[model samples]
Target: MKYLSLIIMILMSPSCSISKKNASVVKEKLIVTFSKGKCLGNCPVYDLYIYNNGRVVYNGIDNVKKKGVYETLIALDTVKRIEYLMKHFSPEEIGNTNGRDIPFTILKINDKKVVYRSTRSSGNLLKINNLIENIKDKL
Candidate 1:
């Protein structure tokens, strides 16, 4: 009986409590990502990842004010708004291009991916650009 009590106490100790690390490890899946490609001129090249848990990560490579890696936790409302925008726009409709000189924008949602390499950006691409800017502002 004493040995059983000791084992139960050990199991219920704070040290054996749910680990924060383990909880964080179960992160929300990737919701959307926007990647800016290099241009002939000094255009900011970076990748932005928006996770379902309202976690945003920006990795800036060159010609940008915010360089290096940046992480921000956005509000749940913002996360929902982004998800709505992505669903409404529908990435599958955007066609892929191979414009090397002009800057390109890559928008991805789960398995569906779209790359916009047009110099004259419009329609859904413009909305995506606006969405990225809105996210950046929030961050």
Candidate 2:
């Protein structure tokens, strides 16, 4: 009886909200940020922030087609992708040593931050980055 009561209490606690089966129903505020630093070569220098509320903010600093702040909304598919990443992908995968580069890329999802200096990136991370670049390019 005591073990059962303890298990019930744990499930009822606030900390269990995220890993629960109903996480999608109780979705938290999601914020994904991507920033790239300058390199000896002219690499794109900018910061991009994506929020679960469908708002996308991009700040183009230097070496890009555009140099300004831009904001827009993202598609529902993008939001779902981000939520999946935040829920499953480990920190090591984000900082995975695929290749090296002169510039550094910083990607932050909620509290986790991955800073990598790589010339190439693959997977959903790459797709999200491309989305940021496209948005900045049009502005």
Candidate 3:
């Protein structure tokens, strides 16, 4: 009888799997767009945020910092743009990420997107203009 009680106690303990709480965390994807490194024209630096729930948030040019940091929510309303960004940028930079994937901050889109390449590949400026141009076709 005592052994049965001990087994029951162990099963009912806080550390038991039945007592554990399920995680409520949700993963999200975000894209940060740019016109120039430091703002050169009317092209607004856009940041498109994409949620796993099919929801999106947009941050336009006005909210962007004057020095040139920009980000906004990606619009699901336009599947063309979303598909373009995901298909191209994913293989080029890091795909539809949660924004913590890369190190460098100055994301530019003038002639091309200059992603900070890794040190092993010489850490040099990896010019992705061609890829961007190809993606531009889809846009």
lDDT, each prediction:
0.75, 0.71, 0.36
- The TM-score, computed over Cα atoms with residue i paired to residue i, of candidate 2 is 0.62
What shift in Å separates residue 133 of candidate 2 from its native position after superposition?
Answer: 4.1
Please say which candidate is ahead in lDDT: 2 or 3. 2
In terms of lDDT, which candidate is stronger, 1 or 2?
A: 1
How do all models score by TM-score? Answer: 0.72, 0.62, 0.28
Model 3: per-residue Cα lDDT at residue 86: 38
Q: Which stretches of model 1 miss by more than 4 angstroms? A: 1-20, 90-100, 137-139
Ranking by TM-score: 1, 2, 3
- Per TM-score, the best of the predicted structures is 1
Q: Candidate 1, residue 97: CA error in Å?
A: 4.3
Ten-residue stretch with the least lDDT total in model 3: 117-126
Number of colliding residue pairs in model 1: 0
Kindly list the per-residue Cα lDDT of model 2 for residues 61-123, writing each as its tens digit: 999876898888878777777667556644444445544457878878888776765445556
